[model samples]
Structure formats: structure tokens, C-alpha cells
Target chain A: MSAQIVAFGLLGGLVLYSAWRVATAPLITHAALFLALTLVGVAGFFFMLQAEFLAVVQILVYVGAVMTVIIFAIMLSTPALIRSGERPTLIQQILSPRYGAIPLLVGVAVTLLLLLAYGTVSWDQVPLTFHPSSQFPGGSTAQGTTGLIGEALLTRYIVPFEVVSLLLLAAMVGAIVLAVEGSRGKEDEARD
Target chain B: MTDVPVEAYLVVAVLLFGLGLFTALRRTNAIMILMGIELMLNAVNLNLVAFSRYLPAGLVDGQVFAVFVITLAAAEAAIGLGIVLMLARKRQSVDVSDFTELKG
Candidate 1:
């Protein structure tokens, strides 16, 4: 009935479509693209949840950085063009058989039951507190979430914030070790 | 839905987890399985972020944890892919089923 419902319905549909694509797309590259769309939808949901900063970070970090890395990895690994006439998987193959429709029907039924059960549950009683909205004083609305987040990171959450940088450093070291192992093996093979 | 319920996030997470699970099971490629592992890790990150948003108190901690998780995911991909590359160089295959030898 309300505009909010319409928006949610649309987002939900988009989420489902992208998720399905993420699962069913045969090519690894298309699956990654679908993952990017799903990430975008998730960022939109974060905005709706009033986490604008998180939404931006999701788009920046996941879409911009991580997905780029994944795409590069895929490109580095796979052949220039996928060989035609290659079979997808047994799951897809099963879809054409006589018993294929049974699993599909069961899945639909389970989804419907879960939806019905969820509708019967009461969720309004959960305790929730929102940060002082940006619309208020302190020029919060004008400056937006980044300033507040930065302030909090420095003042209130300084220790844990720095700890994350260290974690990333460790990850970088680990990645280097793993990547170099491959090169060492290549040199060995050259000798062989 | 008026207010997006916490259950909504959890349900989406469960679905994502399932996709990761299926991918891990069905994909014969070792690199693809690593990608599936990354998906599972992202699903867990989404769950953490969702709880942080809904609960209101554990904001920065959740964000910090998510950052760590993302870093770990990247490291995992690098290491896992490196191993695959080396395996392909040595064993000349990326199929998981081919990895039967215990040692050099």
C-alpha cells in the first residue's frame, strides 16, 4: 500500500534475481558480475538502514577494490574464450530429467512455508536505537556521516581501529607468501 | 515491510550461505571453491554488519571485525590461488579430485 513497501518489493526482487544469477551463471566472470550487482543492492539496503557511511564503504571496497581483484584473477586464470559445448554441471543437467521438477516444487513449497511462518512472527518488539539522525543540529546533516564516523574512529574506537590496519598488514604478508610460492615452483620447473 | 526486520538480513545471509555451500560442493575447480569460500565469508560479514546496524551499540567493533574479515578473505584468495597456480605448474591440473598425493 505504501511507497516504502513498493521500494522494498523492488529491492527484494532484484536481490533474488542477482542471487539466482550468482548461483546459476556458468561462466565465472558472469557470476562475479552478478556478485557485484548483489553487492550494490546490499549497499542500497544499507542506505535504507540509515548507514550511509557503510553503504559507501561497501561500494568502494567491495565493488571497487575486491571485485577488481577477483576479475583480474579470473582473467589471469581462465582461457581467453570459454570452450563451447562444455557441460555446466550435473545439477543443471538434472533439470531436464523427469525428477527435475520435484526438487523445484519442493524448493518453492519450502520458501512459501518459510514466508508464511515469518509472517506469523512478531518482530516489532525488538529493542532498537538509532544514532542521532543527521538532520539535527551540529551541522550533522550538512557534513554527513563521514565526519561523525571519523570522529568516532579517532576518539571512541581508536584502539580497535588501528588493530584493523595491523590485520590488513598481516593479510598482505600472507598473500605475498602464497603468491611467491607459485613463482618459486616455476623456477624449479625451469631447472627440471 | 514497514521496518526492515533483522530476520530479513538473516534470511538473506542464510541464502547466501547456501549458495556458497553449493558452490563449494559442485565446483570441481580449486580456485572456484576458494571463491565460494570468499562468498561464505562475505555472508558472515553481512550478518555482522546487519546485527551492528540493528543493535545500535556494537557499531565500530562490528565494522572493525568486518574489516578484518575482508582482509582475511583477500589473503585467503591470494594464498589459495597461489597454491593452485603452483599445483597446475607441477601436477598440470586444477581439478580438486586430482589432488590425491600426500607429499612430494
Candidate 2:
């Protein structure tokens, strides 16, 4: 009945709808755009959860950077493969036992299993507000969530942070190498 | 102060994960599969942030981990898209069904 629940319901509906479209849209470009909408909805959830920093990052990274990369790849890749071969109606796509049955069953089974496993456990006992002092001893809630996260990254989680930087560097280099190699191969073929 | 139960968030995350799994398995396009993976990762991030908000013990750890997960997702997206572009250039197709052979 509260405003939070109402907001959550709206945002959650948007996310689920967009996610469904992302899964089933006939055009790859449409799916990519739906994926952006889904990410934006998730960012709204982050805002509702009081993780303001993460909400910004979700929008910036997922919707901004990742979606851009995906759209770019879609444009660069094959035009022929972007559209589904048979444009079945949404109802038909769902009703057709052959194409949708297995994946649908698997997805439903996984979701049900997860829900059954976690749903029974009581989550109400958990505290609703974060208390930084409990974890950090001298830490105060006055410190912003973003500031605390930064401190933790530099102090407690420094090793993983550094390692992730290295991993990202490697991935960037590898992507560039693959892209360059692919173009060179095309040039070689043209020459021959 | 929010009365929204953690179960609500869990339900959303679970459904999102299922949708992502369905997309990944059902879609033949490699880029679509990668998008599905991104969706799955986003679901996990949502869980982490939800826990951080409601659980005292989680504190900022969940948020930090979410940041790391986002970073990893970005890296994965870059690498995955790069490979897809390369394959598309080579084969003139991005459909996974077209990629029957391991050795090209």
C-alpha cells in the first residue's frame, strides 16, 4: 500500500516486460533497445533499494556503455541474421510445442526450483537499514554509501580490485587483437 | 523505512534469471545469447544490492561486489562482442546455427 511498493511494482513490470521483449523480439535491433529499457528498470530498482551509486553505475555501464557496444556490433554484423527466419506471431511462438517447449520448460523449472529453495526461508528477520558501524567498528553511518564502498574497495577488497583491473586490461587488449586480426584476414582475402 | 519485503526483489531476480536463461538457450544469435548473459548478470547484481539494503551484515560488501560484477559484465560484453564481430566478418553470419564446426 506504500509508495515504495507501488514504485517497485511499476518498475518491476517494466523490467519484466522489456526483458520478455529482449528475449522474443523478431529484430535484433529491437531486442537491443529492449535490453536498454530492462537495464534502466533495474537501475530504478537500485535507486529504490537506496543504492544510489549503483543506480548511476547501472545506467552508465549497462545502458550506456554495454548497450552502445551491443548496438554497434549489431550494426557491424550480418543484416540477414538480425531478423528471425520465420516471423511467428507471439502467441504462436508460445503455443508452438516444438520450438518453445524445451527452453520454456527448462526456464520454468529453474525458476521454480530457485523460488522453492529460497522462498521458504524467512527474510523478515533481516534489518532494513544498513549499519556501517557493525561491520567497520569505527565506521559511522554519516559516511555516504559511495564513500564507504570506495574505502572498502581500497582497503579490504584491494586485491580483488587490482586483479579486476588487470583482467579488464587483458580483455581490452584481446578484443582489439581479435578485431584487428579479423580485418587483416578480410584484407588478405581481398588481395588473393 | 520501506515496507517492501525482500521476497519481492527475490521474485523479480528469479524471474529475470529465468528469462535470461530462456533467451540464451533459445536464441541462435550469438549477440542475443550474450545479451541474455548480461541479463542474468544484472539479476545477480539486483540480488546483491537488495541484500545489501536489507541485511545489516552485508553492509557495503554487496554493493562493492555488485560493482565488481558490473565491471566483469562490461569486460565480458566487450570480449564477447569482439568475438561475435570477428566471427560475423569471417562467416558473414552471426547465427550460432551457422557455426557448426569448431575448426574454421
In TM-score terms, candidate 1 sits at 0.75
lDDT at B69, model 2: 100
Candidate 1 CAPRI grade: acceptable
Estimate, for each residue in A1-192, the C-alpha lDDT of model 1 and write its tens digit: 656556656766676577666655677777778878877877776666555676788788778877777776666665542343575475864474432344345445545665666678776765755443343222255554456567777888778768767776776787787678778877987999
Against the reference, the lDDT scores of all candidates come to 0.64, 0.87
True contacts kept of each: 0.17, 0.88
Lowest-scoring 10 consecutive residues by lDDT in candidate 1 chain A? A130-139
Predicted structure 1: lDDT:
0.64
The parts of candidate 2 lying over 4 Å away from their true place are: A81-86, A95-99, A124-143
Write candidate 2's Cα lDDT for A90-109 as tens digits: 77776766447777888999
Q: After superposition, how far is residue B19 of candidate 2 from its true place, in Å?
A: 0.5
Question: Ten residues in a row with the worst lDDT in model 2 chain A?
Answer: A131-140
**Per-residue alpha-carbon lDDT of candidate 1 for residues B25-100, written as tens digits (9 for 90 to 100):** 5566676677667667766777776666654433444554565566567656656776666676667677788887
